[model samples]
Target: MQLLRSLLADRDWSQDAVLLSRLQQALLLLRDPAASLDEATWLLVADETAHYLDFRRLRTLEAQLRGCTQDEVRYTRADWQAARTAEAALASHLRHVRFSSYAPEPVPMFRIH
Candidate 1:
């Protein structure tokens, strides 16, 4: 998950549909370690055209993931080490991912008095 962490750490990272989707998956997995990647993918693709949604989207996502939970697996130290190694390896080949035509959500500008 170093790749996910790296993407999240980069302030310049564009919060595009793809990025947001990845974030959602990462968050879901973090919140429920028993959740499988397939479950995350399914929820993200359930509404193919919906790249952005309000917080209510979580409710929708949760509904979709309701049946996909697995019994929590305990992670051994070796498993954690392997995961870290994999993340480090993946981070090496990573490139900045961005959407070509994505227009960011508008932010209100404030002028200092």
Candidate 2:
């Protein structure tokens, strides 16, 4: 992460020209603005670019995360309900945990003379 950040920090991606071009294209494709794109370029976005991605995890959610949307990320009513429930559960758990069998032994206070 540090290395990648360092590399990208300068914003000089000339070292990896191909990756820079593809990333730029992907960003533009995502925007899909009013500007018209060439047919070949438009078709190219459909074909997966090398070193680019298709994240499967975003589509799949574990049983615990049942409230999340499947297709795209959007906060739903279920998500709010789940969040409130989790927050309440966490508070309850913390309260229970606070009442230990006995208080921990106290350490000597630092003396600064």
Each model's lDDT: 0.48, 0.45
Query: In candidate 2, where is summed lDDT lowest over 10 consecutive residues?
Result: 50-59
Those runs of model 1 whose alpha carbons end farther than 4 Å from true positions after fitting are 39-113
Give the per-residue lDDT digits (tens) of candidate 2, residues 44-100: 543323111122222234222766554445533344346557768999988887875
Query: What does each candidate score in C-alpha RMSD?
Result: 21.6, 16.1
Residue-level lDDT for 97 in candidate 2: 76
Candidate 1 per-residue lDDT, tens place, 46-72, comes to: 432242222123334444566432222
TM-score, candidate number 2? 0.25
Poorly placed runs, candidate 2 (over 4 Å)? 1-72, 101-113
* CA lDDT for candidate 1: 0.48
The TM-score obtained by model 1 is 0.27
